[model samples]
Target: MDAKQTNGGRRHFLKTGAAAGLALKVGVTAAEPRASTPALPMPEYEKLDALALASAIREGRLTALEALEAAIARAEARSQINAVALRHFDLARENAQRLSRMGRAERAAWAQTAPLAGVPFALKDLGVAMKGTVTTQGCAFFKDAVADHDSTLVQRYRAAGLNIFAKTTTPEFGQTATTESRLFGLTRNPWNLAYSAGGSSGGAAAAVAAGIVPAAHASDGGGSIRIPSSHCGLFGLKPSRGLVPMGPKMLEGWLGLSAQNVISRSVRDSALLLQLTQGPEAGSRTGPQPGALIDAITRPPRRLRIALMEQNPFGAPVHPECLDAVRAAARLCESLGHVVEMAAPKLAIGEMFGSMGIATAAGMLASVRMREKETGRTAREDEFEPLNWRSLQLARGYSAEQAFTARTVFDQAARTVDLFLGEYDLILSPVTAAPAPLLGAMSLDQPYESFVKVAMTASPFTAIFNMTGHPAMSVPLHWNGAGMPIGAQFAAPFGAEATLLALAAQLEQAAPWKDRRPVL
Candidate 1:
């Protein structure tokens, strides 16, 4: 490559690019155009998940090293878009050693030969899962903070024999919407590095979107999982409040709105992983739900009822393309023999956003307090992103008298879904008000409260399910002009994962994301 006409061109960035080896695909060929800019080894890994990689390993088409090499290389090229906070290549290689020792049949049988068995995977560093790994929480506040134990989801992934490849980034205390944090800078979207991947699971979504890993663990409270998932074009779900357990930390998250799940390329993968990990971990909210979330996916959903609204009910305009996509899905449902009608129960976007703000801000303050208490440290208001600190401040503004009213609003909204759900199998809506935003689009410079407002445009519909404690899944049903993914959310009633999974699986079979990938 010739020297750039300008000193600050991509060429200059390449010299100081400073990509970590373990972050992206490793074996990128030099022939590629982006190769001059330190591209990841292979672009293909951007599209393939652990399950597919496992298949290649079994088929003798690709070795784990080949896969890992490719992933690390991609991280080098794409890390700027979605910063990968931690690398465990040594541990991952150790896990691969065990996988290499196992007979294919043994590994496959144990995986139930499940799709992801023996595949490489990653975890969001936010939750507790020491793995002797860094849990930066996107903060300078806890730069040295390391978890002492694995979160339940980590244990489940290990048991399933998924190689723990890397740790993705997140916002501090996951307080804000975009993925940027002081600890690791920012995680940009693959489609446009200038745009955000969406947060606090933004790093997780970015990694998956950039092809660093096929799928990664993420948690959603006020759209942490789904928002990034939507932005990154991966399938993301916030399992019903209790379907996936959150224990050893708190029995319920965000007053039971948050839950652990993943952003994946396929619905069955989400269902499959949830089946593997979800259940009543001791101290989980409510007892185990039913037979199994995985088995639940195989059965055909009964001829269902569906409510479809192509417009953002909150008065925000759904990008015309997104509106068309939702309408198309409704038409598809109609073709498949389900009842599809335009019915949107009255919902106030402002009230819902306000309640979500309190929940998010309160959670941030709790994390800050916990950090300070445990480490003998205190955070000045300036240490945090203003939006996050202000969220806490706003949360403090409410009185006990207001709490009841907020609860009433949350419960009433959620219950409306319950009642509406009784008449419909699932409610289909745009996952975000629009497509992924440019980086700094949701920047902290805006009034703290305004962040929530801007966030509502794409994320408004998601929090409703969290409020009601119903299971919600985001499916990658549409792609924009840029080939970036846009997801449509399907929400089911409380304890209705069985219902949702069954429906999701059918959709997966009908339209798969298995072969779709970006040019990493």
Candidate 2:
């Protein structure tokens, strides 16, 4: 149908029946008051971060079921964004009801152990798995692929007392920068519905930005975590490779390039989540020990040298607003008593991306083949998106020698970044070369070449740190004349997540972003 006609229908659906059937199917009675008696208004609930919400629940001011219902109400209200891929609202309510059954003394004792107990959380629909849930990964071929077991990360999330209610949208296999796929349509930005919510964690960012939840599970293989955080005005941290578990199903993702974490509104939520979930599982390779991230967030980092890079390494033209955001962040750092200089590590940008592409293609092909074996059906080209089909073809063409060469390049780049960090404590740059693009600008249905061009131009900085295995983050510090959020990127040495979190907390204190919520 025509664009205007389609949007008009969407608006009508959202206004009338978008969430009606889903609420009934999930057995959600959002209008009914809970027994705990006084529930906070939606606005007040949205104002509290996950930590504060947990504190309130612990103190008996609110019940876990009440918080879950509030989140459900918001999610239903913001259904027009199409951010959610799968809803487990009934299961989440069961979990929350279990918590509500506890006595006040029992609840307080449990809260002391499970710091974020009673907070609602969503998982990105790509990497990682939750038992009995279908992790479609935004691919038609995997649309019915139900996970029989939870990934190690999901176990940790449950242990931390987070209520997993839904799965967020993602691009097909998370191959693109924006979250749009045939399986789940466009996940739009909460700030502006026409604009894109950056991906492959777009839905996670959208949920948080829309006030459905204060934080959600997100993974970064390329720029997935930080890109959406930038677009949606949230704080996202991609911990160093091997710090967070990615195992039991797959040992590492994209040859150690992907790290799982959360896209959160507050620094402490991200820090505490990291502290709770990080560490190697049995039989997994471990990276450098991440020091106490909670402690790091509480205390400001010592003033140190920070490198500010404005130019895109790939020679792409960065938007003026993005450049302005980075400059403003640099000035903010200086005001906070840290030294900021204009410098970037020298590296073969072309080779780095080339290696990443090879790894990405191979990973996609492997996943497809594995699924094909399990299902006893070969995947057809028609079943895949254009870019993903092209990726499988490229993966078939590459030789073993080429894959080895890509690994070598990854190693060399990691060494180069490690040495660069010896001279500077952090690298500050734009999370994306531009602010979030409008929807359809980076759709995977387009020609593979054109899609790659747009994706690279939009997110030129984040994948490099992913390749180098360094911890990086996107801090929402600036907004353009149009009021779109622009995030400043920060990268530290491998295993220095503590340092990154500390500085992020400092920035949060110096220029707070907690009060800025999208008017959904």
Candidate 3:
């Protein structure tokens, strides 16, 4: 687990509970390949990108049941990764039949509507809800919090005609970066079974990377989305604070510290999902930008100056290899015809993210307390990692004056990054300080400082955007020679999802990763 291992050897260091899950004795059964991927498809599911699945359905190349069957088979074959949280063969089959009953015009409308229709989408354990299924946020208190109504995101997905085939796992309260929870144990990386998938959206990254669904829903308050996406070699975006709505229940997530988005294998898929799920809910305060997402994907980004970041104020070391990855990405952008230059802005990392973390952890603690009151049970001290307790304490310390000062500081930071973006179309940086880590590399069971250092080191690149409310994305641009994937982040001005998306589309076209996969 040495960070200085130059040869890309074993680098395990996952959050608490993950190190133990890597060798759970759950052997993965390899499914027959789809005639392309280097990794054999697991028995339960064979993933198809959102766009590809729609095309296949439209062309009659495969029925929804056929696709679901392949996916199920692939899931079974790759059981070691432990991606699927709930089996929905019966439900998926039923929905596919219902789709078959649609009239031609209805079917056509469905096809052209949301970018992910007719595709199998896995819902991450948090935020989104599916009726009759448990929506535990990795807590034993509400272990039976079966969802009675669909979350806004889930409703929108259904409206777009996506089949809700399964649910993925998450760490309790999603406080920890690793995805291990007592309920589902641990979710391992698809590339190397001995490593972590990453969290709080770790399960989605693991499932998507394993070709479980091509992509799954992900969220980030403090690098939850980007860290896992970077670790698993997928596309991850944390949108402008208000771009997507969280309504009928919440106006802002983690006091505006988090946003929900998808982590996928393609830029187009992320683009389309952003289009569908972006914008405010009915009772939302603000609406999405006045433009179409499909149109954004087609718009070519103008070549422009770029600001590259490569330093941390927290005394955390950015591994030499990770720095190399960022430099390589800078050169790639130059090769692709953009003026790239190094520029790390002076930022207050620990103070800002610490505040944000407190707010987020407080949200979970509030939930825990509520459950304690309602269910006559509480989370024992031993049940949560030390950082979880610290987050609760930090959030409790938020006085009225402190809250006001925090908001003012965030607004100021937003302006700073906005001014920074005015000169450059994109900001290039490493998504994490290191590459993919081995299981238990990070620990929910460790001391608060130990877990914080590990989690922050791997995810120093993403939270700055949450405070600023900018649109940012993680593109899977690098693969360590030994087969682990690494991601580099690119961010744009506030409300500039279009620019970020178009730039990502250009990269996708130039270096397609559709058929590239792991050998199970």
Considering every candidate listed, which one attains the maximal TM-score? 2
Q: Return the lDDT, model 3, position 200.
A: 85
Better of 1 and 2 by TM-score: 2
Candidates' RMSD to native: 8.6, 9.6, 10.5
- Please report the candidate that would top lDDT against the real structure: 2
Q: 2 or 3: which has the higher TM-score?
A: 2
Taking the tens digit of each residue's C-alpha lDDT, what string does model 1 give over 1-520?
1223422332332233221222223133222123233345544444455655666555434445556767677666565675588888788887676666665566556655345555777788776565577777666676777777777767777877677778888877776668877667778887677788888798888887666777788988877888887777777888877777676676676666678888876665677777778778876547447447777776778888888866675766778767755666676667667787777666766787677666666666677778899799787776777766666677767676666666677778877777777777788887778777776667664685666567667567777787777788777666777767777787877777787778766666666554455555
- Pitting candidate 1 against candidate 3, the one with the higher lDDT is 3
| Model 3, residue 61: C-alpha shift (Å) | 2.4
- lDDT of candidate 2 over 388-490, digit per residue (tens): 9988998999989988898889889999999999999999999998789999989999986777778877668999998889999999989888878999999
Question: Candidate 1 at 167: error in angstroms?
Answer: 1.5
Query: What's model 1's lDDT at 100?
Result: 62
Error of 2 at 164 (Å): 0.4
